[model samples]
Target: MAKKRKVDNLLALAVLSTIVERPMHRYEIAQTLCERGKDRDMAIKWGSLYTVVQNMAKAGFLEVVGSERDGARPERVIYRITDAGRVEMADWTRELLTTPEPEHHRFVAGLSILAVLPPAEVIELLGARLDALGRILEVARRELGDLTGTLPRLFLVESEFGLAMLEAEAAWTRSLRDELIEGSFDGLAQWRDWHDRGMRPSEVTASIERGVAEN
Candidate 1:
């Protein structure tokens, strides 16, 4: 049998969603993803992102609608979603939200399994994340403010709720970071040793598979 086609399914879904919003060239898609990911401190790996795009094109989820020339570079291929792509995107979105939260390597899972991380290091990481989250919450607040007179009431309410949730998370992270810093936990060395010795090959593979599945 032909090797099963394996692509990052979530990444494919994200790419298709972007294309459905508006047909765009590959570079434009990369730029859009970078912009969207700024709050999360993430940028899609270009090679991997393009690979997913190409695979989707081959799978008939996307069609090359046209080409665009930009200065000295070769003509860039612009893509549009086909009907199948729309159906797939809708299905993925619904399934993603409705699916139970996966149990593996979830933030909680990492904390539970690798409880050996130095308290200080964990605090530092959480503090940094909280700072990033605060910045994102601020931007969201500003965007909502700008939409005050322009958006519908339902959208406004939804936006407010999102902002509240972000703020709550930031507060929680801050509290946890403070506790860790004050506690002077020194578990990292022990945790690393445990992780290196305790986990078997099968367990490690299972962890990796769970990570992939969760993503």
Candidate 2:
């Protein structure tokens, strides 16, 4: 299998994409990101944007074009994307789209240690998360609806993918909560007892067979 490479930070991708359209100063890159609502999707801090620009320049992904000064304002060095930048951006985008790499999410990590908490407590926490996901789904749906006529589907497809994933997660969470409440999950007793006994030596073999053995 080919190694999967992707952009770990959105600022790099955003800056490269922007400079490809036209050379921009550091401030302008930040401003354009905000204006296009790119910041909402990524953590594009204004303070760090300049540093990123400097680093990209050092890496030869970007080149300083010319400085512009308007009246009392300081001259800002404009930047344009280099051949390297274009290549990296394309590779990053393609990898992101075509490759399905596991991304870190808090809920999954929480689930890994979920047995540490009581089943009821776990259900409550997951319920809260499901409610929040419901609200986010509603907001995404409404926003997508509002944009339907005004913008192209290409612009909102990212949002659509996000919404679909959120919907699936919410549904799965709800089902899990229901199962816990109804004691319908297979091996619920064995699972609970395994955790309660703290994986005793005698029960280790059975627990392992049932797939509840904890490290």
Give the Cα lDDT of each candidate.
0.71, 0.81
What is candidate 2's local distance difference test score?
A: 0.81
| Positional deviation of residue 29's Cα in model 2 after best superposition, in angstroms | 1.3
Quick one: RMSD of model 2?
Answer: 3.7
**In TM-score terms, which candidate is top?**
2
What is the per-residue lDDT of model 1 for residues 1-215, given as tens digits with 9 covering 90 to 100?
A: 12223344567877886788889988888887666542232347878778889999988899999999979998999999999888878876676567665434345665554344544456677877887897899899898788788867654675677789788878877776775666544544443444667666466557667768999
State the lDDT at 95 in candidate 2: 69
TM-score of each: 0.55, 0.83
**RMSD, each candidate, Å?**
9.4, 3.7
Please state the error at residue 77 of candidate 1 in Å.
Answer: 1.4
Clashes of each: 0, 0
In model 2, what lDDT does residue 22 have? 91
